[model samples]
Target chain A: MPQRYAYLGPQGTFTEAAMRSFPGADEAEHLPYATVPAALDALRRAEVDLAVVALENSVEGSVPTTLDELATGEPLQIVGEAHLPVSFALLVRPGTDLGDIKTVASHPHAQPQCRRWLAENVPHAEWRAATSNAEAAQHVADGHYDAALAGSFAAARYGLSVLAEDIHDVADAVTRFIALRRPGTPPPPTGTDRTTVVAFIGEDHPGALLEILTEFSMRGINLTLIQSRPTGAGLGSYLFWIELEGHVDDARVGEALMGLRRVCADVRFVGSYPRADQVRPEIRRGTHDQDFTEAAAWLASVRSGHA
Target chain B: MPQRYAYLGPQGTFTEAAMRSFPGADEAEHLPYATVPAALDALRRAEVDLAVVALENSVEGSVPTTLDELATGEPLQIVGEAHLPVSFALLVRPGTDLGDIKTVASHPHAQPQCRRWLAENVPHAEWRAATSNAEAAQHVADGHYDAALAGSFAAARYGLSVLAEDIHDVADAVTRFIALRRPGTPPPPTGTDRTTVVAFIGEDHPGALLEILTEFSMRGINLTLIQSRPTGAGLGSYLFWIELEGHVDDARVGEALMGLRRVCADVRFVGSYPRADQVRPEIRRGTHDQDFTEAAAWLASVRSGHA
Candidate 1:
């Protein structure tokens, strides 16, 4: 039996595009779930070998729900990430003209990216939300909606025509997607790897957030993203979704995680995987693995009362 | 002549209270400005010796407008800060009862804090915005509004009766206010001083923010607050308002600033003022000032072939 790959889809979506970008995805059995939670849940229930979900989009920004789900739920390890430059296309039935469009359907996130074009072209159109842009295209194909804002590639899959291509107010929008599997030892350090962790600030620790950032900073790790969200535990406690440069196996990164574990109320190691951009960390002097190892040795000698 | 102190006030407001907390406020001439910008501009124009404005609040969070004003405009140096516990009160005409109130007034920020209380007590009342809570009380005294949510102390100043006091949904809400003056020598290092700076990310630098945090982190300096705001320069460029634990004169902090200045496109030193809470940073073992000094000396010795 081939490995199963689950994604948020109805045949064609940005998520499916992201999933296909992965190695051996064509050889793997493709399973489409109606929702992101459904896809991840299937993976959690051992129904799928792996799950792919959108983590951050340049235009819509970070998906808070996805981050929260990954950070708080039963552990899943991120094996890798993929970046796709996103551009929307208006999909409609072949006979439908821009003037004939009365209602535009798309995922809530996709609609705003083309709101201006829609206003000028389809002045009479009202926006309808769908779980995925592919689902919107599916609806358009079934005569449930006049048009949809989706990827142009989705048009052929849904038997729809590209009414308008490259429909976006902002150019060069990119979405970063992550692939996850059952918690396991992460992929080996690639020198350009990225490690992720969620730090729950301890109660009554006023500067706990600073302490969390300091752990990575002191190790010369560059935190690519820091999204602070309420822990849902109390009156204003926070949990940070921190993504940083370096693999979990790196000496400095291991030390940083240990430091975070020591300070934060709870530190959850998500995983370490190769960065999609493959940009290597700019390791500062005295923060390299050898530096940390030497520093540890120096401390041990000092503790042993050696000069 | 007494030193002139400009504050965002019409008198008897929270800002006035914050301004009065200063050392020579009572001895100095108090000048009330119509708006926060007006108050700071007065200081900039050399019309006042100093200015005080709200920086952050536990209830409303950081005052973005005030922060942006100080960060982007002509530079002002913070010399002091005060944290005042905020609670609102309902003020009305002397003969009026709680039931007589039809419309309530308060600053927009203050109104939300007391929204639940107002809904429970004055369910029929409508909320009106005021420049300041004291102005709301003055409006109540002038019969412009049926009731005003303000500081209880404002009742005595505006000749209004307090119908209810300590009105807030959340308890222990504190607003932090900063005192500013023309750029000059900063106050000598207090062990618990806080340094503020604004760092503009360079045009092409990807992880400039991480580099900024690393500078502080590598020096064992704790960043008490990190507020990222758009530079308004372009579609995605950002500027960060970073407040960290240490004085400008501290060897570690100076080094951190120097490191930041080297990496960031531009680094603006807002000020180094005594922290309102006076919380000293936890200096890690190898990051203390003497450690940095010793490391520099060792590096120099090794470079000169003396190691």
Candidate 2:
């Protein structure tokens, strides 16, 4: 089958890396788009079968465009999700040394991750933003910059040498990207999963928003994230993005979603996918109960309303 | 006295023009920051006595960064606001003509506004995203593109001649910018105006969001726009921005806000001012009635529960 997945870019982007993380990724053609809306438009027109868009990065909170696109009533439905361990590094032309770098170029998303490293190494150098890490790497390759902040994949793709690996200030540098498809073409389940949905309303008057939320709380549904984006209608109302535990097709979840739809103007089920275990079995061999206990505690807080 | 304002760029951004709309503007020193967080940090650190940030543009909706910054736990208070008219035009190098342009470069916000113009005139051309309109103009000057979508102010500043004026599709394009400060130094009421506040959480577990909104309904607080940004904690939680009919200091508004704070986790007043009577008074006369009518209708909706 000729599979097409639309992603934000001019060919190479971190989202493309995330798309490649899909199970049956080999031989899939990638469609590059200038904006998320354009990608979704292509999906609606059936030009692409799927879209891989970045939702949130641990360091950057949420991609408002992704949230907004989901809330804007797209005919596309989210089918699967993947979380890629985003590891950023400083890349430069093949023969360039760290000391030879006068300027560093990168996407804004990369700048924050490499903040500490950039400050310590090139404190006074000017930082410029290119369209993507791949573009930044290309700029470095074209001799526009002595160095660039980019992902490992981008460096390899552009044939640049990594001057430093894993320079992100935070050890937990991860980004969650989602796949979208037309309704009824859902990705097969992988169990231990989660689903995302969004709703829009004008007067979430006092209890309106919560009334919808209670449908999940009463059912013991584990909600992961809730966010809102302005509807651009000039009224102080919103379109909300919400994530909850279990697939939307699950009996309890199905009932909850039905109840939510009745209360919200527009409600959409984005997707259901196996929640990513950032650390694979091989990587978690020795760190067994250490982080797991912390994760459980955080989940408990969320369940108890403290979160 | 050193008054400071923050805009979204290293220098020469449209936000700078909006920031200049503040009263006693000559006393304000422009502080350029790469991101909104940097500016908010300056406000939090007392490094700047006041900060002006762009809240939203009529064509592009609310700026997520500004909304995200407002929702942060901070003492910053909104005390005043201004609506600046936005006029996007196509600019080119001294010798470049309309037909010679193979690409249109602009910030993403300008892209949608100029979509019609681009499609009609530069149909097959590529659209490149620049860091800012000023940067786009600079790139055009640097021969990166034959033309760029820029504001009149940017064209003047960069010495790029305007090839087309008022090319944005929206005739009423305006951006609402707000002035913020630490709690103790709220901007004095210029009188005969309005105020902005953000509220979150609700009284009852079910329909909590709706319950809090009731205060505005009962008190006739006209909400101009309400958007929710992620608190980044868990699902079904958010921070809401609400624009109302009167200043928070007004007795009725004061009572409503006080009541709301008791029911909500936070009821923050961002700022308020007399709504600008005209965005482009000289160019377009007497179109303010449409906005006022819309605002009045929204206010009635809040009161009647139809919104």
**After superposing candidate 1, which stretches have Cα over 4 Å from the reference?**
A1-307
Go through the candidates in order and give each one's C-alpha lDDT: 0.83, 0.69
Model 1 C-alpha lDDT per residue in residues A1-307, reported as the tens digit of each score = 9999999887899999999998879999999998788899999999999999999998888998689889888878899999988788999999888888888999999887888888888888999999889889999999999999999989899899987888888888889999999877677778899988888876746566776777676557899999988877787687889999988778667756655655556777787899999999999755666655554453333223241
lDDT of 2 by residue, A1-307 (tens): 7788788775558888888887556677888898778888888889988888898998888998778767775556676778876677888878787678889998888888888878998787789999787788899888888788877777777878988887788887789888887766344544466777777776656766666676665445667788877888877778778887666445456545654554466565666666776221121111223333443343333223242
Reference-based lDDT, residue A245, model 1:
90
How much of the real interface does each model capture, measured as fnat?
0.03, 0.00
Q: Which candidate tops TM-score?
A: 1
Q: Give the worst 10-residue stretch by lDDT in candidate 1 chain A.
A: A298-307
Clash number by candidate, in order: 0, 19
Candidate whose lDDT is highest: 1
Residue-by-residue lDDT tens digits, candidate 2, B1-307: 6677676664557677777777766787888777777787888998877677788898779988778777766756676677777777788888778778899899888898888879998898899999787788899889888788877777767778888887768887888877777665333444455666677663226766665566555344556677776676667667777776655445445545554554466555565455655221111111133433443343333223243
